[model samples]
Each structure stands twice: as C-alpha cells, then as structure tokens.
Target: MSQIASTDWYRAGAHGIDIRVRLTPKGGRDALDGIVALADGTSVLAARVRSAPEKGAANAALEKLVAGALGVARATVAVASGHKARLKTVHVDGDARELSGALTALAESIGTRPN
Candidate 1:
C-alpha cells in the first residue's frame, strides 16, 4: 500500500474511530471507490452499495462493508449520523490505530485517490 499523510476521512476517538463516508446507493455492486475531497475540502471515504436506499437497507450495507474492510465484527460498526443522506459518519469499536491502518490498506488496494 502506498504511504500517505494522516487522512481526514477518519479520526481516532476514545472508543475507536469515526469515519466519514460518502455513499452511493444502488451503485450496481458493493465496493469502496476510494478517498475523495468535497467542495468544502472535507475528505471522505467513497463507498457504493448494491442495495437501494429504502428503509435503511443502504445504511445497513454500508455498516457491513465498513466492518468487513476494517476486519471487525458487523456488530461493532454503526452509522452514527446521516441516516437519510449520502454522506454519513460511521462509528467502529476497535483499536483506533489498527483500524486506521486497515483503512489505509483498503484504500490503496482499490487504487484510489482524492478526486
């Protein structure tokens, strides 16, 4: 994985970390697109899910995808904010450093950069 400076998409918290995600529902397949910077200069982890954004299906899929990417249990991941919006804040319970490293690796594996 390519090395980069500390990312803004996630922040280490007392319990674990809070990740900023920009989601694309019904995106054909479930995958992490990469890191992206918004117009306001806030970075987010771009993700897509096959599920439609109805009755929280897309939110559930995003939680699962994040848990899998961070090598944590599904129960440990939750959508902390933006229940009905494209951008969301997800909270994961685990070691912050380890999760951050895993996220970095996952991002590199997808070969994506901020756009």
Candidate 2:
C-alpha cells in the first residue's frame, strides 16, 4: 500500500483515482466514518449509505455519497469491483492529486476508527 493514509486505500490512476472502501449498507445516513485496518494488514476507508445492498442500490448510493463529498460529478464515480462485498474498489474520474489530498485530510480528521 502507499503508506499515506489516503493512498493506503486509494491510488492515483490514469483516469483519476482507485479507491478501496468498506461500505456499511442501510446505515442510517450516508457518511464517511474513517479508516480501518484489517487483521490481514489491509487498510480500507469506512463509509455508510442508507440504501440497502440490493439490486445495486447501495453501490449507487455509495458512489453518490463519495462524489458529493469529493465535489465531483456523480457520473464520475463508479464501483469498479466488489459489488456484493463490503469492500469495494471505486474509480473516480478527475484529479488524482486533488482527490488524494482531500481524502488524506478527511482520514486525518476521522482517523482509523472503522464504522
């Protein structure tokens, strides 16, 4: 992983950023809680959405939540993998450095407390 808290879960890519997120479905509201370190030594960003994990609704909600928080267009964010799993890889199309910095700040404020 990248070591930089944000880069640990996300990386700069050709299109923009590849983000690893642990999502909480049907959570009361959409929010980014913080980060979490798994027992296997993997770090993932914690986030929650109100939508249930059915028919891709939760995935859609998660993308929207991330896009809104990052000030990017909703169409720019998409779940790249792990559609049926809690851990998902999302691709955000835009400025990787800018997004990485913003996410780093957010991780610092929230810390790795899990959801």
Candidate 3:
C-alpha cells in the first residue's frame, strides 16, 4: 500500500465519517476502484455497481458496497446526499478513526492510490 492520504475521500465527523464517492452505474460489477480527482481538484472515491441507475437501485448498491468495504452493517451505511447524481456522499455510523482506517486499507488493496 502506498502512502495515500485518506482526507482525499473521507472526513471524520462527530459520530463517524462522510465519504465522497463517484459512482458508475451498470458498471458490470460492484467494486471500489480507488481515489480520483475531478476537474475542480476535489478528490472522490471511485466506485462501480452492477445495478442500473434507476429508482435508487444504484444508490442502494453503493450503500451495500461501502458497508461491506468498511466492515460495517448495511444498516449503518446510507447515502446521505446526491440521490440522483453520479457523485454521492455516504455517511457511516461508527468510530470515525476506525472507519477511516478501513477505507484507507481498502483503497490500498485496490491499488488505486492517487498520485
């Protein structure tokens, strides 16, 4: 795992953390691709889901994927914002530092650390 900063994708809050994700619907698989920088220089976690972007299917899949990645219960993860957009903010209910560490490890395992 390279030395990538977790601040690029997640931020610790009072209860847990908020994660910024750029989701790709109908991506043929559910997976986290790593971190990426948008044109505005804001970084986001790149994720893909096999479900189509219809009637919140993609959003549900994203929540499941994130919960699984962070080793949390599905009920603990929710799409806090961006219900109809490609980019979304997810809120996880847990220890902020623990969740952040899990996300950092997951990103490193995916080998998509930002340069």
Top model number, TM-score: 3
Of candidates 2 and 1, the better by TM-score: 1
| Local distance difference test, candidate 1 | 0.87
Global fold similarity of model 2 (TM-score) = 0.89
- Report the poorest 10 consecutive residues by lDDT, candidate 3: 1-10
Runs of candidate 2 exceeding 4 Å displacement: 1-4
Q: What is the lDDT of residue 21 in candidate 3?
A: 93
- TM-score of every prediction relative to native: 0.90, 0.89, 0.91
lDDT of 3 at 2: 43
lDDT of 3 by residue, 1-115 (tens): 3444668778999899999999999999999988887778777899999999999999999999998888899999999999999989999999988887888788778755553
Candidate 3: clashing pairs of residues: none
Clashing pairs in 1: none
Candidate 2: residue 86 Cα off by (Å): 0.9
